[model samples]
Target: MKWKTASTLALLSAVSLIGSACSGGSGSGSGDSEEVKDASAKESKDPVELVFYSMSRDSEASFNERYGDAIRKKFPNYTIKYIQRAQGSDLPDLINAGTRIDIHWDSIGSFPSSNMVYELSYDMSDLIKKHKVDLSRFEPSLIDAMKQLGNGAIYGLPVYNERMALFYNKDLFDKLNVPYPQDGMTWTELDELAKKLNVEKDGVLYTGFSPSVNHLFLTNQYSLPLLDKSAMRPTITNEKWKQVLELQLLQPTQNPVYQKAMQANKGKILDLNQFAKDQSLAMFISSPLMPLVMKEELSKFNWDLVSEPTMPDAPGVGPQSYPGYFAITKMAKDKDAAMEVIKYLTSDEYQMECAKKGIMTSLKSEEIQKALGQESAFKGKNFGAFFYNKFPAIADKTVEESQVPILATYTKNLNKLSAGEMDINTMMRTADEEASKLLDGLKKK
Candidate 1:
């Protein structure tokens, strides 16, 4: 995909001169070799536009403000292009239109469905070695997840990470005279706390806790596999899966107060909005992006975070790492330059900046973790909760796992379970059967 641009022409000339000088020609001095190396480095940073594509639907202006500006400042010669999904520039659309995407970015869970499915993933192992990129600098789980997704090949570098945390409304807890949630609390203890805070006050039914079910399932601490790849079937009816459902969903909704609240709200899940805006939720288990996403509403309330509640079996282990990665695509016009850009994005300097902005860093650096949210308006908040717990190992997602719409089936059964129409065992069995049917349909297709 290389273009015959002026920089390429100059690079070719530099290579020829360096080869001539190395062959015992005139001007074969060490100084000449150093000059040639410097010239090559400069040419590598020459003016080349890279188009970034993601299904995130972030606006160009937002991307520029968050990352594009820093990238441009770092490599002034390079042009940055962001293809917004909102502009109908999806991977399929770009491919059909012959658009050359240099980089593809998305959460690790999405790579199988998006980049790999479209055959846009480019193995960056050779480039990673060539650039001397230190994979050890990042959280091992993030790197391990990338390799797992690529079947032992490095296809991407993690730029940032997110994880589930227990965000509690300080005001609601104070009103109920309940002590705050402490880090390392087990799910059983958290459930008791939720029960304490689930009372009605001043005509408003304040719920104790609500987890983002999708996030919980995606980052299940049990490292449960949704699909049994060998048999190419859903694995939702396993004992571990049953335990997760009992702990996360059925047991929580079994509370009469929570169930009444759900019925009152017309079966709507008590989500982030209830915690941030309505102020009726006492605690929420969600991503650390909450403060950034609900800046204004969150500013009006008194909230703090603790480590995500753990299972009794997995004491200190939190959810799996949910990281966003930047990968060089197969369609990149200049793979070397693309590699350099992604490497910079994962470097200590940029990662620290991201942390200061309240974005979780993918790096394992203690200094970076300490600096998190320092530059943000909520600097005084409990940023430590983001890294307080150990991340569980990531489970490998199979091809069938990505192809089957099993999560939808789970969500449907969860609704039934929430309304007390089905028991936990029945819900699991129904979800498994439905998911298997969906998988069968896909196989037939």
Candidate 2:
């Protein structure tokens, strides 16, 4: 799992202070003390090399071009050295290898363990107060999510957040003679719209909706947990989870579009390109990244995006989550220097630059929003849809190793449910029982 790569280092030149201590009698002692003090001050003032480990594989050249230039201009005394590591690689092993990584930058989904990161609550609270860092500048959801992940102990600051939105093909809606899905509509309402769009015409099957089931659970707009942490058991047998699965699981068996695609594609799920470039899907829910990926094919089809469909039960809450977070590692050589780097990266100037470069900003400012996607391939699209959703309280992360097996069991049960071999109750109960066994086995080991 190792992908170790190092980028060329950039040195910042600083003038070194020279001192002399006269060598004779009592005056020499005082001169020696003064010389020592001057040396210490000079050492403190000397340029420091701050090693930054970014999880993303942006090469040193691109990093410098996009962000390093701004960073270097702001902190001339500290040189930023980009230390590269592949995502999901062994972070502790890299630390043990004596790599001087001062700051850690990674997506929220790929965050390193607490054993690797320094608990920043005490240190950052002081720095935040001393620097008068405006906590209000960042979105409350971003801050709250970080706090929740750390169990009220802040270990990181969010760099950027992402929200799920519903993208629809305008051409498909027009062809189907159905109105476009509106913002703030419930998922139930979306289901009806999807049914209307599921029509067969001219040898082409149009999919009304093809949302990712995994996304619904991961995003968990309803704050549902697959595993009950306290009891250390699976909770898929619950009514809430049953409804969640029924929403997407039954679609494949019930929807003509999914059935036809599965038959034609040899049992595989619907092809994403069918939805993106082919304009066969009337509506789909996904992150903002989709539009960026389909930017070239977008203009070929008339399409737009809206807020993620609301939860019918909950009404207006949306699942908002931060994608990237920056933290100072426990093994950092210069903690204060790392904090300064984080501060600079999250500052208004840096954020504005990021916004102009089409990088999403974690800061909550009208100016930044207006500037977002300015340089992106989706420059003129509905970038405003990103903010329409409200952030729900983040649920605790499931950390058990058995999560892999649990998800497998759930997938297997989904097949059984689809084949009519098991009812919803049987599907959930069997899945939960198998997941509980896996968890129990892991605990014993």
Candidate 3:
């Protein structure tokens, strides 16, 4: 509700300002006129080169195919220059050399860690107002995420989004005579279904469920913060975290059959590969990109997807939004041009194209949602599952950069907890302690 109000107010303000400028009222001075003219010229069909740096390790070819080509087609007069992450031309290298980076893009999770950490972030609030870019058009959670990262300043616009879903090997379910997972199944229901599928067959153990635990923690449906910024400490020792661990890790690992399977794999946790490649995993909760990423291996097995399982107390809520963003960096020579490019990228027209190409859009348009995966290799699959559940509100980051290492520590402890080496309370306690130590060490540096 707050996001909607904020966006509405912003839109109204931009409109009012534009109307006043156009009317040339007494308040509109000569300088204001020049500024308006300059802004208009920036959006015109003028030839300009924009250098884009991607921290997400997007290759030059991939960038061109996915975005560069489209941008060039849209603005034929514009020259697109892409600099991907590499050994010698990384962010630090570019910054040290004073390279002009007009736009910097990355997943939201990594944006603050890299771009913000380097102080390369440029607040796009004024540009957003000048361009009348309607933030309400995007998924509310996505805009909220960006605002949280910028501490109320608009830093970037979400280009696309990704979310977790329940991917099931239909062949495995048929083989074991278990019903397929449904869309609105709760965690308890999913656990029961997993137990039915976690049986030994043909001398091979079939794991019922193998979720990406890291993703689960990062995008938990409860919107839990991983760290306490005020205290500069980890929040892993809380009761909510313990409940999450018990449901996601402890309960599943408590199965003796699952433990035996882990032992056979030499204590390695079963992953998505086991589901896609080995076909020994029944249900795997993962991102929708899996369909395209593992197209070949997945084609060999009959599979379908359902909405990600929900917590009983938070029914129908899905994981928090994980979207990639397009940000205009502070090093840009022409901020207006950069903002224009970003505005175009997030427009409804481009978002529609992205959806048609089987790319998930950050917009909340029903038409775009329906067109999802329409042109992809997996068109006939249940694409509706992706939108079945409501995305949970994103939690504000505390120590934004400390998340990765703390999560790593928690993940390691999770393995131990699963193997009966530590109880849930002990796991949480130790993880918090280790995370605190890690934060202290980082502060010293």
Among all candidates shown, the one with the greatest lDDT: 1
- In candidate 1, position 182 carries an lDDT of 94
List the global CA lDDT of all models: 0.75, 0.60, 0.73
Tens-digit lDDT track of model 2 for 57-99 = 5556655655466566656677878754555434555656666
After superposition, candidate 1 runs with Cα above 4 Å error: 1-44, 86-88
- Model 1 C-alpha lDDT per residue in residues 1-445, reported as the tens digit of each score: 1212212112211111111110111111112245543543575567889888876666676667666776676667889898878555777888999999999887776678888888898999998876667787889999998888888988788887877788899998988899999998888888888888778768888889876777656788988767776787777777887777777776667787788888887886677667877898898876656666556778998989988888999888888877878889988999988877777677777777677877778889999898887877688888888788887788777666776677777767677777788787888888889998998898889
Sort by lDDT, top down from the best: 1, 3, 2
- In model 2, which runs have C-alpha deviations exceeding 4 angstroms? 1-46, 55-58, 86-89, 112-123, 248-253, 356-358, 401-422
Backbone Cα, N, C clashes tallied per candidate:
0, 0, 0
Q: Residues 209-238, candidate 3: write the lDDT tens digits.
A: 865777657878898877775676787877
Residue range with the least summed lDDT across 10 consecutive positions in model 2: 7-16
